[model samples]
Target: MNLSPAERRAGITVAIFCIAAAALAFGLTLPLLGLLMERDGWSRSAIGLSSAMAPLAILMVSQFMPRLVARFGAKRVILIAALSDAVLLILLKITDDYYLWLPIRFLMGIAISALFVTSESWINEVTENHNRGRVMAIYNIMLSAGFASGPLILVVVGIEGWAPFAAGAIVMMLASLPMIFAKVADPPFEGTASFSVWRYFLVAPTLAGAMLLFAIVENGSTSLLAVYGVRNGLPEGEAVTLISAVVFGGMVMALPVGWLADRMDRIRLLVMLAFMTTAMAILIPWTIADPVWRLVVLFAWGAAASSIYTVAMALQGERFKGADLVTANAAFGTIYGIGSLAGPLVIGGAMDYDDPHGFAWTIIIICAGFLVFTVIRQSMKRG
Candidate 1:
């Protein structure tokens, strides 16, 4: 942990690049698989089940991540995971069988989860408290940018044949290059006897809750926003573009939010963000009718909501260290997986029951619920 400033920067940069590359593969594959399955005459149910495998893998694999990192080291595990991802992407392209894809997706999920858990812990280990916020903010920005770029690459390569899969494999392989050459030490992990990732939930309930809520809202909105747009009378193309607006908003606002996290009370900042998210959710119904205003509202809303994860991560680093921090991040990933699985089900059902407005209403309820929980938690702490 006694890294020089230059070494710390290099370490953080390498970790960020690894995750960003993973994110790029993630963003590409999630949509690519769905489109491919749909084209192959798979039922919606089958496609949904195939998609669920990855998050389910995250839930199953997260508990073991800390130990893996402890045993193999972060850098080695990351390189292995990235290589596994590339191989899996190629496998996905080689086989067109739905049964085969289920396991491939599941294994891909395991590799992807490793990349996130290890890289996040790596970032936290190298970062000092004073600059953790800014560094994590940059981390989040690159993550969003990388994820958003995946679809653009898909557009260029097209989803047919091996082109799309090949693009993803190439990126995954390329993502490992920086780590291979970087002169940085892996974060040290001394495995603990009583180390329980679940226990960290009690240790940092707010951080856990923030990650869960963010995952639900983010996944729910991303999966359904275009559907919501179409139901609300927008053209299909423009409806799809709404997601870009949200991503753009997140990318634009990450740094400023990071600056605030460094200067102010992060818990309070989280509360304010929840409030801003709630306000934006409430405004969506009104704004969806106007093209310009819809983008404006979503932009601000995306900025606030996405910053919740950035600030929560900064808080996690502020509060924990070493093996404990890795476990905490593993817990974060587990909670995120649960929320991702739940979000679409809950939000999609709401939309089914009430059309487009259900989309916004569901988000409003979740954000408001988080806001209330945060206030009560902070009050009890102060008392």
Candidate 2:
């Protein structure tokens, strides 16, 4: 654990260069999420099933990630992820079949898992204990900014044919080239012990519960906003913006939330966010024809909700260490995955009311669920 000046500099450099590459996919993936879902004429079931594969895949694969990192090395896996991500974007642009999209999305999920795990693992290995929190905060900011950028790119590309997808792929390719030159190794895996995910959830129930609830709300929001748009008869391009607006809204507040995370009681902050988010969701269903107001409402929801991820992860960082840490990470990953799968399933299924404004009810239902969870967690006193 001690590092020379040269080593510290090198680690930070690698994180920056590689993270930028990975961030490209974040921006590209935004519009593509809508495009992919719509292109295939996917039922809510199909979108839920396909989208669920990412977190599911993460859970199944993370158990063996240490071994993978040990063998292929982190740099190689990241490069592979980048290359595959580029290819998948190309494939997504060309395909409109539901059947084909399932496998492609699953593979895209794999690529996403690889880059995220590798980026986090690499940083953990290089950073000092004193700096770990700060570095992670920085990384989260980068991811948020990168993710927010995706929608802006879509706005630029104007979302017809393969243009947006192609642009996304190009960004991924560009990110990969510089990292390919750096060729960093996988940082050492921190934890090795196995623990039940349920046990870890108990250790920090508020943070853990918040992670799960927000995952569904956030992922569901991201995945289905476009379809919600199309169902309401908005232009396809405009439909994609609904989701992006929310994400960009979230990004706008990410830095402030990170700053607050250092100052506030994260648990209390999360509880407040739960209330704010629920309010946003309730407003979603009523904004059908009000384009101006829809943006305002979703943006508010995004701003309030974005902090959940950072704070929850901090709770994890506080309570666990070693292999136990990784176990907790995987557990959170599982909860997030399950919630994500359920979001679209529940919302999409509830579309029994075809009224143009009924779409916002989905947000309302999701927000209400978050409210219930918040009350439960806040009221429960862990002895």
Candidate 3:
């Protein structure tokens, strides 16, 4: 798509705003809620269940996004979603009832899902094919940066009272303002919204697999890695830092990973990264005793694992356009939601059953599965 430079800039701005807002809200809410619930004596299982509702909402809401956009336009959908999210964050702060929080989180998921789909579809629509990888890499970097910044914000504002909630609402409201003023035109929705999960699978099974596995690993690790570290004997502060190391790895490695995708066959690169990630996961059990060494492993692991999603997204743009692109992105979100929904349960179960090493083993198993599947998939294609 040959977009005017002005439109391209506006699209990038909007995309950045959407991702940053989502990441900030996510970063603040997850830890804040968990901490709040823990203080209130809620069980870990209960907290996890409350967290799961959002992804479940995303899974349900994503399928209808194409239709929503078709009827209302991407700009309106995104603006409404962001504003609604800001409102929900404030509501979550006021509500002390656990049952009330669950439904509110579910609604937040729906709103955020709309923002995610529209933002990604918009970015794909505006970017030139040749520059897609790097542009997406930058997007991912901003995303990681936003997530990484959230904890810092929490520390500054303190997570105890209404401060963090107010900050999150303000950030989301700011995110919405750009949608109203950006000159970027929404991608014209053509025909009816086609949101078949199986159809996207048929179009690109490898992309589908990448989306699912990446979400599984990413969500699973983010939710449990610190717990795993603590179980394995690391100090609480150090264990938490492990997650930061991983996020740091993702942010630092973005450009190089994107450069490789732009220059090489993305499938082969994905296979290579999968192997590297698997190797790193296997090393974690051995390295867990040494904080520095374990952080190194996580750093490498984050880079390789996170790159899989980056490349998969770039490939989506390479293979599809127009309405197909919109549908495919919705499919990506749906697949990701499914993975996110299941990842924590699976990994947390394994951790409970096996204790310290279970987390590493679960991740290793998932990474190894991806590596083996990709190799076999490619070999069959060559035949």
Candidate 4:
């Protein structure tokens, strides 16, 4: 896996592109996934259930990825995952019933997990410690791009039409070809299957806590803020913009945060991120005056929150390995899926009271998670 510097850069660039594309194509629709579910004759709760399956898929996928990578190679695993997701996304346009989509959504989750695991693993396996932070920063940036771009794709495709799914499918299909042609030496990160979920706290508590809390805050915010905005009296378009602002702002800031995370004390930096995000959530309901101010607040919120996922990953790289790493990711995925499930249900319920009510729930959740996280650090014996 010793690549020339130029080759390393190219490999990273390709990996970033593929991962971003994969995340963008699917992750973007999440904000409106529940709305889409309603259009097709389901409740927000049901939609949340389907969307929650994604995290569960991540949990299930990580448990098996060691063997999958061993048998299929990381590249092939990514290809199959991407291809499987593309097809399922296209099928969403064809089906209006939830019964069919439940399983479809479940499979889509698996596809995303497979794609992401392979995409990151490919680069992480090859990168030296010196360059890993920059590589991770770039990777996180691309993910932000994919997620933010999903709504824009909505503008062109409309939530009801087939066009968005087609575009998503095409992007995923195209993302795979680069790996097929590129020269890469496989450093399969394999290990004994023997491991426990609880062991993750021992291997990497910062990574574990960060992933759990961030999963709740990140996906919850992304998935529910649209409905939250509307409750606050924003026009449909502006409400949509708030979601985009958070994602784009988060994307722009993730790299700098990654750099700082790399250079400074990681736990302290993570604590800073938690406080920053919690503060932003606190500001949201209070600062809903002019549309411009609201957008700025949303942007700041995204910038602060997106770092949770990226930094948690960097922390994992900083400590855990092999089975421990996979288990941590799986546990994160499971908890994140649970968060995704709760977000829409709770937030959608908030919309019933009005938008600020939803924001209140979100704010409380953010603060509670961060506060709990801060206290948990006291008991953790750092690796």
Clashes (N, CA, C under 3 Å) per candidate: 0, 6, 0, 1
Point out where model 1 deviates above 4 Å. 191-195
Task: Write model 4 residue lDDT over 104-190, tens digit each, in one string.
Answer: 877888888777766666666566665556667778887777776776777777776666677888988888878888775544566
TM-score of each: 0.97, 0.74, 0.95, 0.85
Find the 10 residues in a row with the least total lDDT in model 3: 189-198
Residue 187: error of model 3 in Å?
A: 1.8
Tens digits of per-residue lDDT for model 2 on 1-383? 35676776576667655666667665567456755576757675666566565666765565554455556766777778888989987897678566786678778776776777566656655655444444555666677777767777877877778888788888778767756665443355554555665676666666666777777667777766777887888889888889877877776776677667667766777777788888887777677458899889888888777766766665566555545555566566666667766766666666656544445676666667766876776676542
Candidate 3's error at 302, in angstroms? 0.5
lDDT of 2: 0.68
Residue by residue across 1-383, what tens digits does model 3's lDDT show?
56688878778878777878788887788888888899999998899899888899989888788878878988889889998999999999888779899999999999988988888888877887777888888989988888778777888898877899999999998888877776677777456535464588777888898888889988988888999989988889988888888878888898899988889888888899889989999998999898689889999999988888888889888887777778888999899899998998899889889987888899899889888988999999999
User: Superposing every Cα of model 3 onto the true structure, what RMSD results?
Assistant: 1.7
- Candidate 1, residues 1-383, lDDT tens digits: the string is 88899999899988898899889989999999999889989899999999999999998899889888888999999999999999999999888789999999999999989999999999988899987889989999999988888988888999998899999999999989988998998878655624487887778888888999989978987999999999999999999888888878888999999999999998999999989988998999999989999999998888888999999999988988888888888998899999999999999999999987899899899989999899899999999
TM-score of 4: 0.85
Alpha-carbon error at 348 in model 2, in Å?
Answer: 0.9
**Top candidate when judged by lDDT against the true structure:** 1
Residue-level error in angstroms, candidate 3, position 85: 0.5
Q: How far out, in Å, is residue 186 in model 2? A: 4.9
